[model samples]
Target: MNTIEVKNLNFYYGNFQALKDIGIAFQEKIITALIGPSGCGKSTLLRCLNRMNDLIEGVKISGEVDFKDKNIYSKNIDVVELRRHVGMVFQRPNPFPLSVFDNVVYGLKVHGVTQAFRLEEIVERSLKATGLWDEMKDKLNSIATELPLEQQQRLCMARLVAIEPEVILMDEPCSALDPIATAKIEELMFELKKKYTIVIVTHNMQQAARVSDCCGFMLLGELIEFGTTSKIFTSPDNQKTQDYITGRFG
Candidate 1:
């Protein structure tokens, strides 16, 4: 089942077009990776899914972005609730400057979850889901920024999980981590796909191949190709995809 679908989507920042007639569907409970060079609109397209671009000044969009079969850009749609359902993780760790416990429960608190016992339960469960429970259990009061970068990233994920988001959007989530930490994040993505739909914008071709079931290759402001990761890597139907994947050009 497709959880989200984009049709003839176009986005503009002021007078400059950032995306052009893009269309794609993200399968339910699977990982989809968008790969392209910097400034190719990969991240812009990712932000479109959750309407994150709305926060930018003078940003305009034309087209349909259907989430769970409803147009997200509709006048009656609640942007705040839309964002609650589609969580986003940025290129950097970006943990809140609060304690570990507060960071994990931040989302819950925002959404009006105030019971002490319930908050504790959510913190433990979210941390465990991201494989950070043991590491953070004894230091719940420590400042989130004081943790290692990798741990900070995991805490960000945990915060998202506490809110029970349906889709998780990651933009170069591992760009700041070491190889070992990157591997761990990749492993976590696999586990995450069993329950939540994931869409990632990544520059690392290998990471896309290893972690995503479906891959989309973007160039300039358009999607050049999208297909199963195996076919996209081994036998792409588009020359642009082949060139980008084979190191001919990006």
Candidate 2:
């Protein structure tokens, strides 16, 4: 039931090591939250899964990220294809300036899906999957950025879903939303796990506790502890994890 198995993962930004000897396995069809304080390498590790780090300059990585039995770092691997299967949603709601319909089908369009009927069906399906269809169906041609924050974030997620990704990586997905919007996103995260393996890097401890099936506690650049959400929150095996969860110190 493991979707991703990362072994001895090490990453460097220039000469500074951002991740050190990290090893972890993410379960399939569940939400795994990586929680830590700011600048703790949680986001760096999340980006490594789908090779987003490749876009950064002066970066080096050494590890085996076996995703669906294929080494993601293999020389012949196609990053675009890899990213198509492993989608990402950023901290902020970054909808394209295009219409809601365009935003939803943008991925499909980029991948050469141009049939009008198929595109329309995908837009409806993806939007409905993310709970945006009912609200935005009438305003399909409206500008994406003009929507509310919650709808915008959901639209971003709907866009990802349109491509039928197997895994979704979210970096502080609810950070920019208000309380109500955050709650809606959290609910959406819960629903998404049934179909896609979700990995989320979140600073919000309560949100992590509520949405994730499993949790990993990171410190500095290492995974201090990882286990079921109940166990991690109630009785962590490591003192660092306990201290972090108890608010003694992050």
Against the true structure, whose TM-score is highest? 1
User: What value does the lDDT take at residue 86 in candidate 1?
Assistant: 98
Q: What is the lDDT of residue 204 in candidate 1?
A: 97
Model 2's number of clashes is 0
User: What is the C-alpha local distance difference test score of each model?
Assistant: 0.95, 0.94
Q: Which residue pairs clash within candidate 1?
A: none
On the 0 to 100 scale, the lDDT of residue 183 in model 1 is 99
lDDT of 2 by residue, 7-83 (tens): 99999999999999999999999999999988889999999999999999999999899999889998989999999
Candidate 1 has a TM-score of 0.99
Badly placed stretches (over 4 Å) of model 1 are none
Task: Give per-residue lDDT, candidate 2, residue 74.
Answer: 88
Candidate RMSDs in order: 0.6, 0.7
TM-score of each: 0.99, 0.98
Please name the candidate that would achieve the greatest lDDT relative to the true structure: 1
